[model samples]
Every structure is written in structure tokens, then in C-alpha cells.
Target: MASALPNSLFQQYFNNNDYADIIVELKHPVQDTNCPKSTEYFPMHQIIACSTSTYFKEACFNAETNPIGTKLLFFDISLEAFTIIAAWVYGFRGSSFERLFTEKSIRGVMDFFIDHDLETDIYPEMQELRTLLLKNLFKITTEAEVASATGSPRMDLRSLEDICEYCLPGDRNTIRRLVKQQIPQIKCSAGWLEALAGKSAAGFLASILLEIYQEAQIQ
Candidate 1:
């Protein structure tokens, strides 16, 4: 048995020109003029990038069409989502992934990976982003909680209940706790019923039901 090497060893090679044999450039449709320099370029290992993503596999290994030294530019992907992806490929499980996977970037990450050929359906690791998105959705740190009680919902929370089927031990409990914090607000929302009505929202609905059942039993 061997103790695993620290993530720093691999992360040192992240975006490092010294070790990088490949480059990645991600482009979103719109970027803030205020923060232009942050999302410029990414230096990556050819083998690591190609192994993790099929898109990179084609770009790096398809010498006939794309070649080895070609710029790997991805369109319609935000820097936040790209950071999550890049961090994952670099074997980063610390602050980088946690800090970037927020409410703002959750939608962008989910939509882009789901649409693009991330092959999340085939690989369980890629689905962590989906789980992060689900967990963030339950983090209702908005005025909606109080507003909904008074009939003026500030949050337009819709289509957020499609929970992913994958779990990593305490993932469900974490999501359950967050949802419990916002359950009052969610119940007040007019669209919660509509959103949770379909088969896709079964897991989300179950979480809510369990919460209610527990509260009732306690009372």
C-alpha cells in the first residue's frame, strides 16, 4: 500500500508553462469588461487533459484534423465553469473547486457540461459538478424566504429541483440540511409544486417529504 501524493505535486503543473505541453482557451459569449485578464489562458498537460475529456482527447490526439500544438479553444463556456473543470482535471479537491462552485456558476457549469461532450452520463466523477449545483440551489440566501411568506417572492426559482442520481456518502445529508433551511420559503413559492410535479424531481420531492414527515413526527 502507498500513501497518495499531495495534490500540490500535480497542481504545480497546472497552468505552468514549464510542464505544460498543451494550452486551453475558453470563451464565454459575454465577459465583464471589469475583469478581462482573469480568463485569458490555461496551461495543461496533454495526457491529463486528453484522458479526462473526450473533447480534449480529440483536440490533442487527432493529429490529422486538430494536431498537437493547436489552440484548444472552447466557446460558450464561462471562466467559472472552466475553472471547475480545469481544477478537476488537475486533481484539485480543495478551495479552488469549492470556491468556484457557487450559485452563480452552478447553472453555467451544469448547462455547458450537460450539453457538451463531457460524457457525464458515462463517468461518475464529472457528475460532482451536478451535485454541487444541486447543493447550491438549496442554499437559499435570498430575500425570497421572507418575501414569499408575505406573497412577494423575489426569487424566480424554477426548474431547480432536478436532483442528480449520484451521491458521495454524505452528499444527500448536506443537500438535505440546506434544503431544510429553505423549506419554508420553498413551500411558499408558487412554482415549487409545479417544479416538483414531474418524475425528474422525485429525489427533490422525497427530500422535502422526509423533512415534513420528520417535523410532524417531532410535533
Candidate 2:
């Protein structure tokens, strides 16, 4: 890495900073009849990297020098309001297939949604996020690939029952430990379930199962 490289190297490289340069608003006059403010303002740059690094892959290291998959993110920082706004006019406007899978943008979007201010205008923000997820979903392998990984073909009810049996009562503690250990190993999300069913059944089952899991922990 070059010493003179921008301090936002990680963000720049991973987020395609070369193409998505932050638009900095320099000192400019505000048109206010009551009180016109003319203050010397410099573009303050802020780089926020994710606190968790588990999801990011090793190939991300080559992003700076290679043409690997990376999302182009550009935003404006306002010190006065202590707020950051997406400067969509300055960079790639929407999420594309090239951006999501290679990078951990999906997880980033999930983390962002966790604390997102929904009261504010969320339609545009969510649309962009949805675009990213859909594009990535298209690149995912077939359901058979998942079955191959789990050594079970298309998770049937028997498999679900077997897993559930181990997660009950005395077996529950052991199952919890196993779940923690295998959280990364087993892909059991709405997305995973959908892959198994090839339809909308996953959402219905996920809601029911999540409730079951919650109730089971109550006693």
C-alpha cells in the first residue's frame, strides 16, 4: 500500500472510492434573508469501518490492487448537524450485482437496518438496500449446492424433527452449544429455507419457527 494513499484506504478500496468520491461542500454562502452565514468550511472526511470483521472475506485485501467486487459508496458529512447523508448524485446511484457478493455489503445493510431511523425518509434508503440484496441473491448457487454442503438433500420434515429433538429440555443446552458452534456452519435463514422450497414457504415457516424458538426459551 502506498504511504500517500488516502486514510480511507479500506473504505476507498472496498467501496470503490476511485469511482465513488465523496462530494465535499466547501465554504459557500447560504441564502438567508434574516441571517446570511458566510463561514469558511472545509470538507471533513470521515471513514467508518464495521466493528465486526467476521463476514468479510480475505479476497477483500486485493480490492485495492485488483478489479474484484466492491460497492461504490459515497456520502456527505456535515459537521454542523453531526449527520451523514448519502450523496447519491456523486456516485453510483443504485446497488448492482458487482457490488454485493464479493463484499460484505449485505451484512452491512443488515447492521444498518438494525439502527436505521425509520421515521425519516426510508423509502429511498430501503430501495437501495433491496437492490443490493436482490442482485446478490441472483448470484447465489442452486439449492442443491446447499444440500451438498449439509450432506442432506432438501431439508425434509424428518431432518427438522431430528434437529428439534436435540434442542429440547436437557438436550436443549447441548443443542444451544451446538447451535453456537455451528451457527456459521449451518445456513438456516429465511433465505436458506427459501432456497430449499424454491418458493414463499420459507417466510411462513420462519415466522412460526422463530416464535417456537422464543417460547421454548421462556420456561
Candidate 3:
């Protein structure tokens, strides 16, 4: 087997724009006249892109079909989302890159995956995360319905946008009926944002979601 190239080499290739063979552009999902997504452009090597991505491989190498010298591909995703993926492919890894995936940004990334119907293509680990984000959406929606009827504050919300981007709407009436009284109270907590971003707080979040899903499972 041939030897793998060092990440440093790819890093150099990524940074030196004059040597770039392809340009990947991020397209805004929304078309508001006032504001839009970052719609950023990233120029890189065809070899790096083709080696790592099947989509780019098919596009770049299909010379007969793909027009020669036309290298711009529109990626309808958030800048923050594309940055994380692009950085990883170009040898920019670690926590700093991960920080780019804020709660809102990850939701936007997942929206791109969901829009392309690429949920089936995600890794098993990512599938779990997708499931969790969807479940959190469900948990909150159900609680909201219950609260509307019983007059209580919505509880244990992970993020509706985070979930809607991945999962379909569930039966609003069904989960509402399951819990007549909202046993889960809305209590302010510190570090909730940090907790939601990592797996460290997953158990706690899962427990809350479970309680809500299990009809508050309370006496």
C-alpha cells in the first residue's frame, strides 16, 4: 500500500491559495434581502478534496461531464459548519475547531444533512447524537402542549431548531395527553449551555428527556 501523506503537507496545501485547484463556496440557506449566511469561499487542492470526499471525487474527476476549469461548488450550509469540516480535512483539528460548532451552528449543519436526506449517511456515533437532538425537540414540544393545557412553564428544552433540523414532527396531541400534570419543573441552572454542548451532561439531559417521554413517570 502507498504511504499516507502527513497532515502538515495538507495544511500547507490548504493555506497556499495560489496552489488551489478547487473552490468550495457556502450558500446561504435563506435569501433574506437584509442578511444571509456567511456564504464563505474556501479554495483547496483537488487531490485533498477527492481523497477525502466521495462527492468531490466524483465531481472533480468527471472531467468529461464536469466543465473544465469550473471549480466552484455551492455548499448550502452554515460557515461555522463548513469551517469545522473543512478544517478537519485540511489538518486543522482539536478543540479550537470544535468550538466553531456552537449550538446554533451545529443545528445549521444538521439542517444541511437533513435537507439532503443524508441522515442515513451519518456515523453510528453521529446517529446517536442526531437521535438525541430529535428527542430533545420532541421532549420540549410535548411539554409545551401539556403546559398549555395545564398552565405550567416549558421544561427541559434542549432546542427546537436543533431537533427540527433532523427529525419530523411528532404527534403533539399524543405526548400532551400522556402527561396531564407537568411534574418536571422549570428550575434555573448554571452552565446549561456548556452542559448541552458536551457528552458530560448527556446523562442528565437524557434523564430529563426520559422523564418527560415516560409521561413524567411520577406519582
Per-residue alpha-carbon lDDT of model 1 for 127-218, expressed as tens digits? 65456556664553344344555663323333334333322334656655655555544443324444454545254555554565556557
- Among these predictions, the greatest TM-score belongs to 1
Model 3 worst lDDT run, 10 consecutive residues: 171-180
lDDT of 3 by residue, 1-219 (tens): 111777677767764577677777777755666776656787767777666555456556653323556466677886676665566566555554455545556666567666755455433333434454443445556556566666664534544223432442232233333223443454323345345535542433433444444543453
Q: Tens digit of lDDT per residue, candidate 2, span 1-219?
A: 112334334333332334432223322235585675444232212232211121111212322332543322322222221111222111223343233243233333433433333212334444443444433322232242454666532333334433332121323343334333333233354445444444342333333444444544574
Output the TM-score of candidate 2.
0.26
Pairs clashing within candidate 2:
none
Task: List the candidate numbers ranked by TM-score, top first.
Answer: 1, 3, 2
Q: After superposition, how far is residue 163 of candidate 1 from its true place, in Å?
A: 8.7
Q: Please identify which of the two predictions, 1 or 3, would achieve the higher lDDT against the true structure.
A: 1
Better of 1 and 3 by TM-score: 1
Is candidate 2 or 3 superior in lDDT? 3
The lDDT per prediction is 0.56, 0.33, 0.53
In candidate 3, position 45 carries an lDDT of 76
Q: In angstroms, what RMSD does candidate 3 have relative to the true structure?
A: 11.0
TM-score of each: 0.61, 0.26, 0.52
